[model samples]
Target: MKPPPGGLTAYEAAGARYERQPYNRSGRSGLKLPAVSLGLWHNFGDDRPVATSRAILRKAFDLGVTHFDLANNYGVPYGSAEANFGTIFQQDFLRYRDELIVSTKAGYDMWPGPYGEWGSRKYVLASLEQSLKRMRLDYVDIFYSHRPDPDTPLEETMGALDHAVRSGKALYAGVSNYSPEQTAQAARIMRELGTPLLIHQPSYSMVNRHIEGGLLDTLEQEGMGCIVYSPLQQGLLTDRYLKGVPDDSRAATSRFLSEEQVNRELAGGLNKIAEQRGQSLAQMALSWALRDPRVTSVLIGASSTAQLEANVAMVDGPPFTDDELAAIDELTGPASSANR
Candidate 1:
């Protein structure tokens, strides 16, 4: 809770933040996000020291990771991620706010009561107001309806996103966790409202290829950019689980990834392929996620500056060849035991 030794000073970002990374255009829009963005879904909560979270944020920005994604229920205690991020931004990164693409979402369970969650206009707008207040910002670069609300009319949910942009509270509108058909509907609605959907954040990893089922095609046809989350599959695709789960791994501690999911026998084959390509399993997984042209960026999280550096290094790895792609397909194909 206390400030770092010297008491914070006016921090200057790294000159190399934009040097090595490549930026991808977001769905024909003027916005170009780094191929790899930083997500605050983990470790930026109340459980960790505020100084640790601040270091991660500063490192990410110093690496040219302009886009930072957040949601209403990101932290262990819900809202704390934004609160923590706001503090860091104010202390060190506020001056470069315009150079960053800070985003937050609503439409998830953040509190009690009927209006506490979902895609109702009341809930979406109110939740964003709370998020903005927590982040201490006037507007988010992109605001999303965190997930689909089956009971709510698509128009209403999409309208809330459109409203967020049109009203000067959000620079862009988006939706997350919606199906291919649902995404098409939301995009159509936003286009009709004159806002035009900006991006779609989905869970797409080597093992979890559900986005390949139809979502990627939908985004491509609609000219909407796709930024996927869980590119590491909660550590399932990383070296940490390839040699058996470490005592400190997420699988060992977080409910999101269970220890049983760590199947070294299944992952060993992919790890071998990664080694053949002279890349780490984590680096290979990130490269595989960006192979599709529709994907604008891959969202990654880090527990420390070292992990962040390793993930960002994927941008410099060699491209997958035809044989490598075939090998990967075989490894992640429906018949593969590792496919999840």
Candidate 2:
């Protein structure tokens, strides 16, 4: 559905929105994303209240969070997050279209048929169309191949992304969950196609530091920005799991984070470090992730405005000292060199 005749006037964004947040250029590209972007992977689903979801989106934009990330199968029932975001967009963000960086990905399972998933030209292109319809947008700012497909040729997958950009369905192309070698190959193909891979979205945090070994270097070589997801390790790096898994926490209800992986000993140590730095565990985790200049942005999922605000406030925290870095590495162990 189209936006209201004059757009929604009840909710006006803050005049100092840009002042509240900093922007970072996505690699060598002209695009600049907010230092901390909001991802609709968790709380924007149909299982959650629409009012809550709407509030988060409005708060994010008002705080100058220009980038909002999503995937085709993000919600509980699948596709609900995009649908909810689409509704919120029509009511709130329609007028600020050019000011936002809306993005979505494909390659994950969204349907049952052979063409339903993976990086095939058919699946990738078709999924983009579906995502656009669900999000009620003509085009997304960036479209990504969610993951690499062993069966489909790399050329076919990259071609789909190239087509997405060249056809105006997406402004730029990206990939996620790809290894260093796969990223290099994908970058090569997109560059040859004249579309150039713009970024890579990978899971990274204090505990999950696999990207440190090679992905960061590969992205730097390819001139592609790196936006990391799960910077909190699905709430593992936060104080939430310090005492024990809360009944309402992701560890209790979600498969992505299990109760068995709480690692209270590690979190307790990290929490102590955060306390010494005068910041919360979540804030310190985010600050730590952005400590690497190679990282362009960090994606955070929030269940409330308070959570979102606190995470965004990490930008104001003091920089990590050499001792702090060493302490963190000591607690979390050295970052693995294993590619993935």
- Models, CA RMSD each: 2.2, 2.6
In candidate 1, the residue pairs with backbone N, CA or C atoms under 3 Å apart (3 or more residues apart, or in different chains) clash, namely none
Tens digits of per-residue lDDT, candidate 2, 1-340, equal 4433333335678889999788999999999999999999998888998888888888898888999999999997899999989988888888899999999999899999899999999999999999999999999999999999999999999999999999999999999999999999999988889999999999998888999889899999999999999999899888899999899999999978778888899999999999999999999999999999889999999999999999999989999999999999998877843111
Q: Which candidate is the best by lDDT?
A: 2
Candidate 1 C-alpha lDDT tens digits along 97-196: 8999999998889999999998999999999999999999999999999899989999998888888898899999888999999999999988898999
> Which ten-residue region of model 2 has the weakest summed lDDT?
1-10
Report how far residue 7 has shifted in candidate 1, in Å: 6.7
Q: What lDDT is reached at residue 124 by model 2? A: 95
